[model samples]
Target: MAHTTDETLTVLVYSDDRNTREQVRTALGRRPAADLPELDYLECATTPAVLRALEKGGVDLCVLDGEAVPVGGLGLGRQLKDEIYGCPPVLVLIGRPQDSWLAAWSRADAAISRPVDPVALAEAAATLLRSRTAGRAPATR
Candidate 1:
């Protein structure tokens, strides 16, 4: 769908589990911050769905559940970075702090651990959204 200048940023969230996706949506609420655009989530349950969402364009940022089945978020994030031109900043949900290296390897822009803390998730997502918004080309709006 074409994004209009309605002050809402598109956030693509991928997770194999419904509960995991719900937690992410709840934590993010309507917007990560007042300074950032209000979020409109595009939920994806599979790797193919994620790819399709990204392909549709106007994705301001992505939140990926690293524990997702089959193709995990980290692996998908890497693929996205490799293949998508001007990919949006990605925030990965990790299983462990030690997996930070893996997140980096995936070329994720930011990460937070599971049992997600609402504050931390919101803050991290907001940071990425702000950064991506700032870096956007003039016609992005």
Candidate 2:
């Protein structure tokens, strides 16, 4: 899909830890790839906030923290997948590479292990965003 330069994609970042959210935003920057549209981020520090933001719509992608307290992103991701009429692609932040299977169980579109590798995070996010721009249907569980 060809995106206009003026177009900006909205990415929702959900993490209870402030640092995790900041890291994601910093890693993604203004745009993950030159071809994709610029990014606008919406940070949610709580599960309720994440749900509320998603309900309002307009989110192109989601970066969720799997290690978050009370309700983890993996569970939340699953909830979004099952509940949301058309949930946006979700990129889950896992604690280790081996936890990728858990990410799959959560129905996340992509998974990245923290301490946030800027290159990998950007690439994963960019790919999901591009898929969104291409109007690809969300993957089924």
Candidate 3:
């Protein structure tokens, strides 16, 4: 569903590190675009938490940290893409531009590097959000 002007989009951000999650949240802000709905974030610090959130649905976009431990976001993104029907568009944060291939392998819709640039992250996130909400207003969170 395409997000309406007032509906808040549910964004799932996954990372073992809290700071990384915070960075992502900060970069994306409450509304990436004047045309889009406000963003509401769900932070996940572990794999199971991520899955649990996804299973419940309503996630418009996912920002995954590629450097997470035990299980990196790249692998997790791939798993979610395969396991979750209608999986939300994924925007992965990698350590380097060279890792873009990994993000592609993970089936992420977009990829950006660490030391997150707010402009880039916001742009990428907005693009994915738009793609997901292309034809219907997003379901309320």
Candidate 4:
């Protein structure tokens, strides 16, 4: 898949908290890296919304909040990896650095601790996006 400059990649941001979703969108801005196409975010505050968006397809990446209530990203990420065919790369936000092992268990492509450092989030997101666009398999554990 060749992406042109005009193409905008779709990124799915899943969190029950509106603030978390906003933080991710703001941190990422219009584009995470200059080499990648601009991003179009599909924000989902509920699990059903997330499922619908993903099932409908065209999501290039997933950013899930580990602290989200009802269902955390770690469990959700694991489910997506297990269930969704050709699931896009997942970046999970963990509560602490120590939870990186949980991220590995979830099978996320990448993980970052929350308080959502803009720089780290951007770097991780850009890396996953690059892999997605480049037709490379997303890294596992």
Best by TM-score: 3
User: Could you give me the TM-score of model 1 versus the true structure?
Assistant: 0.91
Model 3 residue 105 lDDT score:
99
Runs in model 2 deviating more than 4 A are: 1-5, 135-141
lDDT of 4 by residue, 88-125 (tens): 99999999999999999999999989899999999999
lDDT of each: 0.88, 0.90, 0.91, 0.90
lDDT agreement of model 1 with the native: 0.88
Candidate 4 positional error at 36, Å:
0.6
Q: What would you estimate as the lDDT of candidate 4?
A: 0.90
Give per-residue lDDT, candidate 1, residue 40: 87
Where model 4 places Cα greater than 4 Å from the true spot, the runs are: 1-5, 135-141
Q: How much does candidate 3 score in TM-score?
A: 0.94
Candidate 2 C-alpha lDDT tens digits along 1-141: 566666788999999999999999999999999887788889998999998998888899999999999899999999999999879999999999999999999999999998899999999998888778686532222
TM-score of each candidate?
0.91, 0.92, 0.94, 0.92
Candidate 3 lDDT score relative to the true structure: 0.91
lDDT of 1 by residue, 36-84 (tens): 6678889999999988888878888899999999889999999999999
Where in model 1 is the C-alpha error above 4 Å? Answer: 1-5, 135-141
Q: Write the per-residue lDDT of candidate 3 for residues 88-119, one digit (tens) a residue.
A: 99999999999999999999999999889999
Measured over all alpha carbons after superposition, the RMSD of each candidate to the real structure, in angstroms, is 3.7, 3.8, 2.0, 4.2
Candidate 1, clashing residue pairs? none
